[model samples]
Target chain A: MTVLEARDVSYQYSVGTPFQITALEHISFSVEKGELLAIIGHTGSGKSTLIQHFNALLKPTSGQILLYGKDINETKETARDARFKVGLCFQYPEYQLFESTVYKDIAFGPGNMGLSKEEIDARVRRAAAFVGLTEPMLEKSPFDLSGGEKRRVAIAGVMAMEPEVLIMDEPAAGLDPRGRRKILEMIENYRRQTGSTVIIVSHSMEDVASLAERILVLNHGKIARMGTVDEVFSHAEELQNMGLNIPQLTGIFTRLNQLGYGVNPLTYTVEQAKTEILRYLHKGGAADG
Target chain B: MENDSLIKFNDVSYRYESDTDTPLPLAIKNIDLDIRKGEFVAVLGHNGSGKSTLAKLANAILAPESGKIFVNGMDTSDESLEYEIRQTVGVVFQNPDNQIVATIVEEDVAFGPENLGIEPKEIRRRVDDALKSVGMYEYRFHEPHKLSGGQKQRVAIAGIMAMQTECIILDEPTAMLDPKGREEVMKAMQRLNKELGVTIVLITHYMDEAVKADRVIVMDSGRIVLDGTPRQVFAEEETIEKAGLELPDCAKLAHALKRSGVNMPSDILTPDEFVEAFQRCVSGGGVL
Candidate 1:
């Protein structure tokens, strides 16, 4: 089922002024239920603007945003309704953590939804567990935790609402390897537990390659390509030309193929690359014979 | 070498006064560090590892609770030398949006020199040269807000360059940028380090960026756990991981190959190195 869709979406900033600029033009795509999609593009390439339209945060200057095959912006109540069903966690979410305690922070979203105290408490505990926050830490002020822990509080705040579709923008940016791993692990766990559709807006190709089921390449306000990981990543030269990056492990394979090594450039994960390179080495580098 | 060192820390220790007063107050423990002139150094650590604290100490943004930091033999703790110390060491923080002051790129770049009360002609020459050096001359008249993340960052670097600061410390400058923007900032830093012989102290989480630096410093729990050349530092895979960091994917693959009884070097940091190793293995006289 198509949970979220953009039909002929277009947006312009400062329209009809001397500084007028087209931010998005005729952008169209559909995201399925339970599918993990990563939207990638260079800075100011309309990624942030495109995500905003999904929840009717920014109505397309032209074009319709469809939720469950119905226009989300059809009415004021529907536009407000779409916000809860599609939780959008903006970049650097930790800075938005102004709650007194981690538990209260996580409960804020559900509280806004008018859930019962018992239900809100249950959801808060569950969300905290999803991000690996301890019982004692929940009582502490969200401001007192480490950078990684604080990030978890903000993510948990969004997850607590239990949105049908979860979208996070650069959740792991500026984190250490362990912190990043924790966030990635929590996302995988969240999907496995809830089977929710996940859309991540990120600039790190490596992170996208490791988790996303499909990838969307955005250019200067348009969809350059949208496909499964193999389809998008295999066209390494094309993505690079658009000022994007492939996974580091994939880049190695890409370079080897460019060097006449005949290695498979579709290798994205480290484990996959290890197996392919091992096979090639044991086979005397003969890729096909 | 000691005499030529631009910044030296003698048994430095810094403690952040947390509001909650949680344990682990020491942001950086007792340590000694020497940053020499014209050296390009990369600092690697996860968040809360005190790398930023070390950067702040270099220019006297924060005085050490204990120990002493000296910039150009002038103590950072000495209030009289504070201006000269900051003039000697320039720091660029993570967000370009926060660092930028003036509306226009050229004006922002010229802000430092103008603040230093340089002659109008000298400021004009320095601003143009600085902007040109960072490849942002074309965007000089453009609004700083209109430029891309990378362009804004380069403009920040140009602002520092206009001050003629001998050393530049960048704290996670590319963390918020896209891959292309990250690449652009790295190229500018490299150019500034090479062409002008400006010392660079880069604090980053990306292992790939660290590969370009002359030296790599890894911190864990507010202490330097590993410090050496990129090759030497990355060779300690276990140590890097223990510090809450990971090796670059290429280097990790090389290590995996080494563990599986292949003859690949454990320190391969880039795709080019990995390809060369694979080629060697495929050409025989190796595991096959």
Candidate 2:
């Protein structure tokens, strides 16, 4: 089922002014239930603007967004409910952490949902665990925690709301390797546990290659391409022409193919590259006849 | 002085004051570092690992709680020489929005030199040269707010260049930018170093960016845990992992190939180097 759909959506910023700009135009895509979608684009490619429209944070100037087959703008209640169903976590969410304690911060979303105290408490604890926050740290001030810990708490705040479609914009930005892996794992765990649809807007091709089930390429406020990891990364020349990059591993294999090695050019992940090389070695250092 | 170090830290230690009378741990402690003149150095650290503290110490943003820091032979702790030190070593921060103060690109580029009370003609010349160096001369008339993040960051670099600083320290400048923006900023930094012989101290979390630097410094728990060339530092995968970092993907692949009994070097830093080594092996028929 299409949980979220944007039908010919277009958004304009500062409309009716000399500085008016069309941020997004004629954008159309549907996200299915329990799918992990990664949106990749350069800065100011309308990735952020498009995700903002997901939760009705920014309404399109033209066309409409549908949630579960009903136009979100059909009724104010539907629009309001869409916000709850599609939680949008902005970039650098840690900066938005203003609550005194980590526990309260995570609970803020559930509390806004008007859930019972016990239900809110349960969700808060669950969300914290998903992000690997220890119980003792929950009572401490969110301000005192390390950068990685604070980012997790902020992410947990959104996860507590239990949104059916979780959308995060550059959730792992500026984090170290361990922190990045932890957050990516937390997102994967959240999806597995809730079976929720996940949408991530990121600039890291490697992260997208590793995590996303399908990838969407945005360029100049339009849909440039959309496909699975291999399908998208295989179009390396096109992406480079658009000022984008393929995964380093994929690029290595592509060069190998150009150098007369028979390795698959679509090898985007490290594991696939490893397996392909091992197979070639096992085949007596020659392409299979 | 034999190495012509531009910045030096001697037993420097810093601790942030607690907000609620609860004692906080030291931010950076007992750090000794030397940055050579006209060298491009990359700092790698997790958050709160004292990399930012080190950058601030160079430009005198934060005073050392103990010991001393020297920028261009002047002590950073000396209030009398603060202005000269800041002028000598410029710092660019992560957010492009915060660094930009002017509405227009050329105006923002000229803000630093203008603050120094330079003549109008000299300011104009510096602004034009700086903007052109960063490849942002075409966007000089555009509003800074309307520019892309990469272009805004280049403008920030141009602002720094307009100051005629000998050294530039960037604290995660590419953290908020996309890949294209990152490439742009890195290219600008490289140009600044090569063309002007400006020393660069880039602190970044991205391993790929670190590959371009002449030397890499890894920080952990307020200490210099690893310091060497990119190839040397990244070859110590276990050490990097212990410091909460990772090898660049190309290096990881090369290591994996070596581990699986392929005769490959373990220190491949960039994709191009990896391709070259793999090609040699393939053509030489060493590793199928």
lDDT of candidates 1 onward, in order: 0.88, 0.89
Chain A of candidate 1: what's the TM-score? Answer: 0.96
Which candidate leads in DockQ? 1
Q: For all candidates, state DockQ relative to the true structure.
A: 0.64, 0.63
Provide the lDDT at A47 for model 2: 89
Q: Which candidate gets the maximum TM-score versus the true structure?
A: 2
Per residue, candidate 2 scores C-alpha lDDT tens digits across A139-186 of: 999998988899999999999999999999999988988899889999
* After superposition, candidate 2 runs with Cα above 4 Å error: A287-289, B20-22, B132-151
| lDDT, model 2, position A266 | 77
The docking quality of candidate 2, as DockQ, is 0.63
Q: List the residue pairs that clash in candidate 1.
A: none
TM-score of chain B of 1: 0.94
Where is the poorest 10-residue window by lDDT in model 2 chain B?
A: B279-288
Chain B TM-score, one value per candidate, order as shown: 0.94, 0.94
